[model samples]
Target: MKAKIKATWVSVFLLIAIEQTIKIIIYNNFFDKRFAILPPILYFEPMFNRHYSWFNSMLKLNAGKGLHIAVVVILSILVIVFYRFLTKRIGSIKIVNIMFAFLFSGAMCSLIDKVFWDGSLDYIMLKGFFTFDLKDLYIDVFIGLMILLLFTKNEQLKQIDEKVLLKDFLDCLLNKKHY
Candidate 1:
């Protein structure tokens, strides 16, 4: 258990460092300079994103930084809370540790970007789609791995009762049980 926790923290910090370092390097050298990596498909153009998320930008919400930070905090809290349910239902497996580390690192990086970089330091742009940074990659990797895990662990996951799990999670959240 101790080893797992230590490994997870180390991985999270390493990922966070790598993501922030790349963002800083691109911010200093490639900010606003567009170069076609793959013509009409991909490009590198570093810039600060003022919008909280792509959804916000797509909808032109222009949500304030305070709201963005608050949302991130809430999301982070949810992740931590969800972990108890995850460990209880699936057991503390290595892949679970890896997924949570990626998620934690990504969320922490987003918070750092908001507080320090003024927003996400987006550099990789897909033609007409959107621009994103390494933090996004971390989250994407976590999501991909989770999907793969679900597919591979379908039988194991199906054995768990979701309603009871939800009730337990809520009980933990309401301080009725130790998560």
Candidate 2:
């Protein structure tokens, strides 16, 4: 159990480290509309998301710092709530693991943007619909997986638990009749 806890935190930290490293590299080298590594599908493009800034404008008044702080605070709250829920030791709901994975990966990914980009990096352009980065993709996929896990996690477990309870109740009734 202790090892599992340590591994979980290590995984979270590793993701955070990788994300922040990429953000720092992009900020220092490519802070504008520049692309390297060829292939528009996969390269760093420096752009700001004003919609994500608390100051109503990206690259304004330490807004990045404020956003980073806000993200960190929110992530901390999520970790706490998740920990509480996991501690309940409820039925075999794999959703708890999925939630932790999404929570940590998403938080780390966004935290990197907030800390290093003065705003988010708008990389990975796709057919003029959504712009994102590798980190963003990681966060998005994990979150999507977490949502799907929510719908399916309990179905099999619910059946097993119900069967166990029914069998136990029947056994008790039969025992009482014999007595």
Candidate 3:
């Protein structure tokens, strides 16, 4: 289990490093260049997102980097609490670790983007919709797997106590409990 957890972290950091490296390379060398993978549908076009996500931009959040980082931190806290809950309930299952890793990596990448990049450097464009980057793909994996788990691991997930999870998170934030 420990090995699995270690592998999860290693995989996540590798994904982050690779994704960010690609983003940085493209941003540096081809910021305005667009290469069509599927012309008129999908393309790799760089975009600098000052907001955290497309949802935030669409809603016109326009929040400062400080606020963005704060939100990411809070999200990360929630993710950790939930992950700890799962580990306690089901042990360190690899699939669960991978699932949480996706969420964790996405949050960490977003936090990094806020602190260092001023915003996310999105390069994947979906015509008539929005542009996203690799971090977005990481988040997407979590969402997809979570939905699948909701049905497949329904019994285990049903053991989740929302109230307890919330309390645990609050306790951690208040330094009243150690996670």
Best by lDDT: 1
TM-score per model over all chains:
0.90, 0.60, 0.85
Q: Each model's number of backbone clashes?
A: 0, 0, 0
Count clashing pairs, candidate 2: 0
lDDT of 3 by residue, 63-119 (tens): 777877888899898788777766765678766898888889988998888888988
How do these models rank on lDDT, best leading?
1, 3, 2
Model 3's TM-score against the true structure: 0.85
Clashing pairs in 1: none
Off by over 4 Å in 3: 153-179
**Higher-lDDT candidate of 1 and 2:** 1
Q: What is the lDDT of residue 97 in candidate 2?
A: 53
lDDT of 2 by residue, 31-150 (tens): 665564446555555566644443444335644467555867786675755454343333324455545655667666666556655457665555435556656666677778766755
1 or 3, greater by lDDT: 1
